[model samples]
Each structure stands twice: as structure tokens, then as C-alpha cells.
Target chain A: MNETSRAVGWKPRGWDVLNIVLLSLLALATMYPFYYIFIYSISVPEEALKGVYLIPRGFSLQNYVHIFKQDNILWAFFISVARTVVGTVLTLLCCTAFSYGISKRNVPFRKLMYGAVIVTMYISPGLIPWYITMKSYGLQNNFLLYILPGLMVAFYIVLIKTYIEELPAALEESAMVDGASYYQMLFRIVLPLSIPVLATVAIFNAVNQWNSWVDNLYLASDLKLQTLQMLLYTYVNQQTAALSMINSNSTAQTAFVMTPTSVQMTITMIATLPILFVYPFLQRFFLKGLMLGAVKG
Target chain B: MEKTAPRKRKIEVPLLVLTVPFFLIVVLFSYVPLWGWSIAFVDYVPGRSILESAFAGFKYFHRLFDSTSDFGTVLRNTLVLSFLHLICSPLPVLLAIMITNLRSGRFAKFIQTVTSFPNFISWIIVYSVFFSFFSIDDGMLNKLLYGTLHWIKEPSNLLSDPRWTWWFMTLATVWKTVGWTAIIYIAAIAGIDQEQYQAAEVDGASRFKQAIHITIPGIMPTFTILLLLNIGNMLNVGFDQYYVFGNALVQEKIDVIDTYTYRVGLLNMDFSYSTAAGIFKSLVSVILLFTANFVTRRTSGRSIM
Candidate 1:
């Protein structure tokens, strides 16, 4: 009732109008790139070449069709999904286990282990040596390449540990007095209480695994294991590849296809859409974790 | 206090067993990579045993410092880019404040969603967007400048041009990242005490003044935390964005230490030289981190590591 009364009493002032106008302009500018991509993806090829198509010159699905028909896209998509899921799960388990152990009041060698973890977060040993080590371990051209090195995200471990520490000590203490083992209390009490942090870490890891191109560039030499980001990298970064895309789209076999502009935009949309799809389900937990660090810092 | 004597208590069998995998994995993957720093001190043959290779101490480092080396250019590019990003860090804080002050929640959320969306996409995919706006023949920028405004005599492929690489990379990155960064500040503002604002309002303080004196000050700790971390990370201009955006024409202007290492290590197969470069980069960064942490601890009295 108080909030409602305040809202009703708050009248428009000179600054309020200025704020609204400024915000509207910002909203338009912030969204213009996505809008540009959308219209270009659907625009008629001839009209697209002439100039900007604020509205798509023609309502067309040919760009998406061409993108779908491209070779290796399905395989690449499969690799992305498989890596994202496998990587996130493994990373969470590894991170949570360490976080749990370190947070325990009675754990032995806790300070030393925590120091070991924190050191890795700051010191990035050069990539070349890491590559050499992975090759020695037989990770090159391997499907497990995506799953192994990423098993422990040091930063997320710190975050999860912070959350676990804040969890009511009494709750865990009572469980311990009932003769619960460390692992039992972890699986039963700690994890259930830490779902929001877990979800936030999961989303972070999943998006990271999905968007990473570095691993594929250096490690995934075999055609079968290449991720989607690599395909996009090669297509857009190389002028010759882009020229071929244009030429191929103009051919009789692809005569009805949208221009190279449309295909580029469509592929980009496909690459980006997966994260946005999962975002809604995870947003509440993400917001919770965002506040957690701030409130407690 | 619980016994500081950690060695007296017998370690639990199950607890030790369960955590061994995490322990072994970190040492193997994280610490073992550091072991590769030895390659910088010796000639590393890909197929041969690293032990069999002859020692080549300091040669690569000398080469890097030589006049003909691209190291200077790469360092300049990296510093310029990091400086640009550091300068724009305040933009996100301002954006957060603006969003907090907005009259409508729906519009604020909508703006945030749009702003943070680009961060989800990889740099590779972002290059496609860059292509559309800067292509020589039919790019939106070219059309706007040449056809409409008559600003330039000839159409230039702004995306591919060497001169525009620094500004383009920095601005494009800032565009994609500012929203994600701003959310941290927003969370900090939300965590501020409500009584301060109420008290200020009771004293007839304006919203603008309240925001300036209360809201901004409240988020200063968060800002300092981020500032210290950013300074610590100033040396490592990440590889992916430069690797995907760089062309032969703009190689000198856009190449960073990470990408330079990649080209030297993988494509050119100068494994030893690249390892030396990587080791050098890491050493500098570690020094920067300690220095930045010390300064932050003294000033803000807050430290991360």
C-alpha cells in the first residue's frame, strides 16, 4: 500500500521526461545490431546489395535453408552440445567437491589445498606447453579433449566455496552429530542448499564451452571433432572462403538462395540462439548468485 | 581454535579418496602446464624427446627484443587495447546508474537484455556482423558514407583496413561486453542500505543528489575490486578475438602476444621460441598481479588473492 501510494504520487517532472527520452534512445541503439542482422538475413538479394534494408526487402527463408544444408554444421552442432553438457557437469563436480572439502571446518591440509587452488587461478602457464602436455596425454584429436582440461574451473571453485561457507553452520553441525559422514552431508545437505550457485556456475561453464574456439583451433585436428565455433571462424576470418560462399550462393544449384549477406547473418543467429534458449530457465539462479557476492563482500 | 596441528589427526579414508581425483586432475592439468616452462630454456623438437634437445637459453628472448622483431608492435597493440578497455570501464557503472534511475522496470530489463546479448556470441560469429557493416562493396558504412553523405571519395573496406584495427577491436569488444560488466555494479547498488536513501529523501535531497552521494559511493568497493583485477590482467590480451579478426594486411597493427605465440608455436612450428615468448608473457603478468594487489590492498584495503 505504501509503495502503491508512492507510485501514484510520483508525478512526471522535467528530468523524468529527459530520462525517458534518453532511455528510449539507448534502447533503440542497443538493439539496432540484432535488428540489422534480422532484416539482412531476410532481405531480397538484389535489394540487399543496393543499400540498407530497414525492413527486409523480401520475406525469405532461403538463408536459413542454405545454412542448414551446409556440410559439417550438424557434426559441429553435435560437438558443441556434447562438449557443453559434458564439460559443465564435469566442471561442477570437480569444483563442488573441492569447494566442499575446503569449506569443511575439520578438513586436514585445508589451507595448503586452498593455496594450491588459488595459485592456478592467477598463473596461466603458457598455452604451448599445455598443448605439449595434452599431446603427451593423447588428448589431441580426441573427443575427451573438450571434457578433460576444463574439468576444474578454479574461479568457480572459489565462488562455490564462498557460498558453502555462508550456509548455516548449525545445519551441517546437527547432521554431523547424527553420525553423518562427510560425503553423506555433502550430497544430502550441502548440495541441496547450494543449487543456486551450482546453476550459476553451470550456465557460465556451458556458455564458455559452447563459445570457445581456442581448444578447437589448437587441439581438434580431426574433421570429426571440430566444434561449430571453428567453422564460423574459418568462414568469416578468411576472405577467400567468404568469396567462395558468395560464388556458390550465386550458382544455379543455389540460384534461389539468399545473398552472402543473408547467409552470414543466418549462421551467426544459429550460433548465438542456443545460449538465449537456456537463459530463461537459469536467469533466476543467475540473479541470485549475482547478488550473493555483492551482499556478502 | 581447532588444532592448528593439522598433522596429528588421521585423514579420513573416504574423504581423502573422494578428493584425490580433484587433487590429481589439478596437478596434472594446471601445474603440469607450468612444467612446460622448461621448453623455453631448451630447443624443443616436436617428435623428439625434450631431454634430447640441446639447450638454447636466452636466444629466443634476445630475438624478441631485436629491432626486427614484431614484439614491440604486438606490445603496443596490447597496451593500446587494454588502455581503451580500462578507460571505458566507467561506462558500465554509468549505465547501471542510469538503468537504476529509470521510471519503468520493463524498459530497464529490456535494455539490459539487448545490451548483454552480444556477450553470449563468440568473436568468430561477431566477425560476421562486422563484415556486414564494413564490407568494401556493399557494406552499410560504405553506403552511408559514400552514397548518402559523400564523405569519402572511395569506398574503403573499414573492417580489413590496418589503420582502423585498434579502434574497431576495442569499440567492438566494449559494445559486446559493457552490459555484462554493468550487472555487477547494479547488484552492488541493490545491496546498498535503503535507509540512507530514505533519510536523504526526508531531508529534501533530490533524486540526482541522492544517487550521486549515496548510490555511487555505495558501489565504490565493487568498482575497486574490478579495477584491481583488470590491472592485474592488463598484459594478457586474449587470443581468440585477435586470431579471428586479424588478416595478413593488419597483422602488425592487430597482433597481440597470445596470437603471436599461437602463430609462432603452431603455424610456424617454432615451438621453442613460442614457449619462450609465452613464459615471458606469464612472468610479466605474475609480477603485474602482485604489484596491483599490493597497491589495491594499501588503498582500498581489499584484495582478491
Candidate 2:
């Protein structure tokens, strides 16, 4: 490709340079907000109050120290982790198993069941009905609300099923010949072979579970069930109230020094940190998963 | 084949048993909600069975169209937001083309990676980032404009300003999704036959000409399918972005159907009326989807469904 472009005497033209420059500006624009937040979180409260741009004026871990001291922050972090781990695992298991069943052409009511799942991808019963249904199911204020309703996402089911259908049937046939039960085949043969798609689904589910707070807002009102995202939303929306709550809990010296802006940035960093850490490693899989879904969809 | 057929039959019952739990879950979560649609038709009362509630016929649906209701504002916001989104749909294609045209593969990859990062973060964090930059007081933009640059005399409350709410929401959504959406177009560009590019190059077509004549046309099918899908989702301006960005000051401008439903059903305890609005939205969405599909099938000789 390089040789061909060279053969055409294709040098770095003005348009190419302009494209590169504009894209770099876009990339900077996308990244600068996060950088600004990080700098503000670490800068001295007085300096951050004046406004931070480009870099931190004074380095301090005081904001983080104060964040860690708050019990609700720690509790929300714990709840967020619990939901991501448990929710992703259950979603993978249930969605993959169900997709495996649906992949079988000879299963009774296979078309009906598969059609039902696909239909859901197009239509939703809207928010009010969905809320009413969840409330009736005793999911309000329940941890199961996070795990159960999301267990078998129709999109994930379709992705896994498409992958499973394309797999070599010989392996499953051989396993069945060995008298492997349906459970054993699913756990042993299908699940093992479906790792790529499963990894994709797992990352998608984990990120969603971590990022979601609306369910917490609407269905689960218990303080104990609050996730990190919910806490961030609360802090962002109710800045003065959150600031007072933080100041009221802190020692006088620290409270006097700490500003609401720094605390807010600190909380924002905390909520976003985990995703930042894992994104680079898992992004390729989700991107691949997306392409796979796009093709099948 | 005969031996395997018998074996398959033998385990059929177990397979059916394995599927029952998932089937039940789908029915409970997805199908059961349809029953709640009935609330829109009746005088739904809490703690009473839907069947026992007094039948109100189409009273709520009629009220949805009444000039006095908030539905008019909600519908206007929803359509305006959706239209803004539709107009900006070409951005991802533009981004994809630019990324593909880059001379350095590594820089293109870096651009893609960084731009897509925002998509993974939650809207709450996005709001936090927005607040830090655009909030009225002590926000970075305000501080810079009113303090350092003296670009403006007073701090601008970009987040709460009602006049530009639709456009601002569109910008936020585009910023969050453009990179992610471009991936599919990038994939489509990759799928375009390499021979076509080679042929164009051999014919003395400049790279710019090649992109215009070949690459843009190649990705049209994917673009069309996505546009149709967006049309199908015309009423669903999403619940999250609006919900988080909304303030009492901007409520009139930002209250799309989903947020309106949530406020009326849960906050105001008007479940029946909200259900009526929701049902109307859903019915229109389904009709739009089929209409788009039908139009595509008729015009392009292909159907999205």
C-alpha cells in the first residue's frame, strides 16, 4: 500500500496535513475535559476555585483523602463493584445458555422463541409500563432488579446465537455422541467455543452495569443500593447540598480548605477511573462485538 | 444422521427444560409490560387489579392531544431533538472518511481510541465533565470567558439555558457517540472492494476523486440502513442525557417523551395518563419503523428487517 501510494507520487499533500491537524484538534477537544477535571481534582482548592486549565497549579492528594473518608462514597463503590461483577456473570451465563438453545434448529418452538426475542429488539413497552411491571415484580429497592431484568438481553442473545450457529457443528455432535447432557454440552462444548463473543458480551454488560444509575434512581431508592454513578449524579446535580454534607462531616481545617469544585472533580475522577483503567484492554473486543452485531443485525 | 437424530430427540425434553427458565424470564420482563399498556385505556387505580379499574375508554389519549396538556411541548421537544440528530447523522461518516484517509495508521488508531473513550463513560460522568466546564458559576468556561479573556461580562449558564437546549443536547449526544458510530462506517469502508481503489488509482483518479466517486458510494448502504433505524427511533430521544442535563429552568425545552412519562407516572403519580402518552409514542415508533422499512424495500429493492 505504501509502495503504491509512493508510485503515484503521493506526498503529504495540503489536504492530508489539514485532515491530520483537524483530527488532532478533535482528539484534544475530546480529551481536554477529562484532563481538566483531573488537574482540578489534584490542585489546591484556592487555585482550583480560580479555575484550572492546561495543568494543576498546586499538587494535593487532600481531595482524594477526603473522598476516601466519606462512608457513603466507599459504600457506593462497593455496590458498584458488586453489581458489575455479579450482573456481568449472570448475564453471560443466562444469555449464552439461552442463545445456545435457540441456536438449535430442531428445538420445539425454536422459531417462536427466537422470534419473541428478536421482536423485543425492535419494540419496547415504554417507560411507564416497564416501571409498573418492575414494581409489581417486587424489584423495587432490590438488588435483583439490577441482575434479573438484564439477565437475557435480546441483542446479546442474538450476537451469541449468530456466533454459535456459525461454529462447526461437528464438535457438539461428537460431544453429544459421548452422551453429554444438554447442560454439559452447553457448559463444556458451546460455552468454551463461544469465548470470543462471550468476552464481548461480558465487557458490554460490565460497562453497562457500572455506568447505569437510572435504575438506582427510579427503582431502588435505598441508600445502601446506590452505585458510584448514582453518587456522582447526586453530587453533580445537588452541588450545594453535597458540599454542605461533605463540609459538615469533615474536620474544620480541611472543610475550610476544601472547595465544592475540587470535591466534585474528585468524585467524577473516582466514578470514571475504573472504566479508564479497563477500557484499553477490553475495547478491541467490544469493537469487534459491535461489528459482529452490525453484520448480523 | 439417523443415529444422531434419535440422540437429539432423546435430549429434546432436557433442552426444552433448559429453555423454559429463559423463556419465562423474557415473558415476565418483555411481554408482561404489554399488559400494563392497558392502564392507558382504563382509569387505572393503584392497589387494584387493572381489570377492576373503571374503564375510561380513550379519555387519556384524548387528553394527550388536548392543547392544555404538556404533551404538546413534550412532542415538540422530542421531534426537534430527533430532527437535530438526523441532520448531524453524516458526522460519523465524515469522521470515518477522515480517519481512513490519514497517512499514518497509528495516529488514526490513536484518534479513534481517544474519541471513542467518551462513549464508554456514563452520562453522569459526562454531566460532571460538562458541569466542570460549562456550569454557570466556577465552571472552567465561565471562569475563562468572564475572568481571564473578558470574552463576556457575565458567566454564561450553558447548561441551564433554554434557548439552545435542543442543540446542546444534540452536541452532547454527537460528542459521545460519533466515534463509536464511525466504527461501523469504517468497517463498511474496509468492506469496499480493494480492487475498486486500485482500479481508480490506475485510471489516474486522484485520491480525492477516488474518495468522492468510490468510497462515499460504497458506504451508502450502511448509512441508509442506520438512517432508517434512526427514523424508526424518532420518538425515543433517550431518557438518560435529557434526564441528567434537565433543570427546572430548561425543563420546558428538554422534556422529551421518555422523561415526560417518568415525571408524570412516577413523580406526579399520574400512571394512567403517562401510560397513554407512552402507548402513543410506542405505536407511532412501530409504525414509523415499518414505514421506513417498507419505503426502503420499495425504493432500494432491500428491506432493513
TM-scores for candidates 1 onward, in order: 0.88, 0.95
Which ranges of candidate 2 are over 4 A from the true structure?
A1-12, A253-256, B1-11
lDDT of 2 at B144: 93
True contacts kept of each: 0.58, 0.70
Residues B1-305, candidate 1, lDDT per residue (tens digit)?
Answer: 23345565667666765566687898999998787888887888898777888998898889888999888888888888888888888888988888888778898887777676777778887777777678785578788888888999999876778889888888888877887788778878988999998998776666777778999899988888788788888878798788878888889788899998999899999998898889888888888889888988898887756
Question: Candidate 1 lDDT, tens digit per residue, A148-169?
Answer: 9988877788789998998999
Residue A118 in model 1: lDDT: 73
Worst 10 residues of 1 chain B by lDDT: B1-10
In Å, residue A60's CA in model 1 sits off its true spot by: 2.7
| TM-score of candidate 1 chain B vs. the reference | 0.90
* lDDT (C-alpha) at residue A12 in model 2: 39
Give the whole-model CA lDDT for all candidates, comma-separated.
Answer: 0.79, 0.88
* Top model number, TM-score: 2
The reply for model 1, stretches above 4 Å from the true place, is A1-14, A44-47, A101-108, A165-190, A239-255, A281-284, A291-297, B1-11, B144-153, B194-212
What CA RMSD would you report for each candidate?
5.1, 3.2
